[model samples]
Target: MTLFIGIVIFLVTFVFMEFMAWFSHKYIMHGFLWVLHKDHHHKDHDSWFERNDAFFIIYAVVSMSFIITASNTWFWYGLPIGFGIMAYGAAYFLVHDIFIHQRFKLLRNANNWYARGVRRAHKIHHKHLGKEEGECFGMLFVPFKYFKK
Candidate 1:
């Protein structure tokens, strides 16, 4: 029962996280909240925690509380949702902080697929001033279709 619940939690959480990533990237990061996110782009290399990554903290607190309460009361439903949010955060960390920004350069070899995709997309995003502002606003996966003129 525990294993099944965990798996379900992870999958559901993953989906929710993806949607949240997209929504937040599109609206929050690119929206009125750019002040916070702008620091990610221009600041002179600060501590990992110094970046405006607090949104994740807010998200974790809210989602964790809801998940815990739901798990205790409603049982398994909360598991997936909570896990999904976590998965999204993980993805964002990898795609946004690591690959896209070249912060985690260990996997930057031109041969690697993740390195190539994320780096290229991010470069293109940075190439334009008005359009691609900060983050790609597409999370881990930015299909070429999105960049079409």
Candidate 2:
């Protein structure tokens, strides 16, 4: 039963990360920390990397901390939570960076309805260069209106 509970916890954590992503993007990324995230929307640097990449590092550290704690009394929960966070981070990277932004030049040929919707939503969000006017949405949860037939 412990293994089942861990799996459940992992799924829950994975789902919850969507809300966390949306919240952080809307508030923190577009809020006071816009200085870090602004370059992501606007191409001011010649380098492929942006200061906004720091957010990924922050999340990696948080996920690693949970994994490290799994050796302790919190093993059951910590293990699942850590993996869940890491999984979500991976998905976010693939979808937001590679697929949507074409950072890696892969997954560009995905032209299904879901892929089109995600790309459309992200395009709308990026239409605003400034942080104040940009719309925020989670990597996996684009608005229904964006998913037009």
Candidate 3:
């Protein structure tokens, strides 16, 4: 029963993180923190990393808090939740950074329909180099209109 609960917690947390990602990207990142996220849309630095990458630290601290709470407190479900958040982060990095942005030289040839759709949606998001008037969608759950037929 505990294992099943843990798995459920993990899956639920993973799905919830998608909504959180979209919310934060639209409101927080594009809101006051546009100073950081704008560089992602516009190239102002020569380094391999963007100031926008700082956002990950917030999620990292959150995930670590969950793991530490699980270790020292009664909230054992935090373990699964932490892992779920980390897993979603991994997926976002793989799809957004590695596959879509080509931050690394891998996953560049994933020419499937889903991959194309994700890329197209992201392309639309990046079309606006500013904070306002941008459409921020979930990483895994893009609109069907963005997908190809």
Please give, for residues 1-149, the per-residue lDDT of candidate 2 as tens digits: 98899999999999999999999999999998999999999989899999999999999999999988996764658989999999999999999999988899899789999999999999999999998878889977788998988
Supply candidate 3's per-residue lDDT for 58.
85
lDDT of 1 by residue, 65-123 (tens): 76897768956677667767766777777777775566767545555654555566767
Candidate 1, residue 4: how far the Cα is off, in Å: 6.0
Model 1 score (lDDT): 0.66
Candidate 3, which segments miss by more than 4 Å at Cα?
none
Task: List candidate 1 segments past 4 Å from native.
Answer: 1-9, 44-48, 128-137, 144-149
RMSD values for the candidates in order, in angstroms, are 4.1, 1.0, 0.7
Q: Which of 1 and 2 is ahead in lDDT?
A: 2
Show the lowest summed lDDT stretch of 10 residues, model 1: 128-137
The number of residue pairs in model 1 that clash at the backbone is: 5
Residue 31 of model 1: what lDDT? 79
lDDT of each: 0.66, 0.92, 0.92
Ranking by lDDT: 3, 2, 1
Query: Considering TM-score, which of the candidate structures 1 and 3 is the better prediction for this target?
Result: 3
Question: Local error of candidate 1 at 43, Å?
Answer: 1.8
RMSD, model 1, all Cα superposed?
4.1
lDDT of 3 by residue, 84-106 (tens): 99999988888888999999999
Q: What is candidate 3's CA lDDT for residue 120?
A: 93
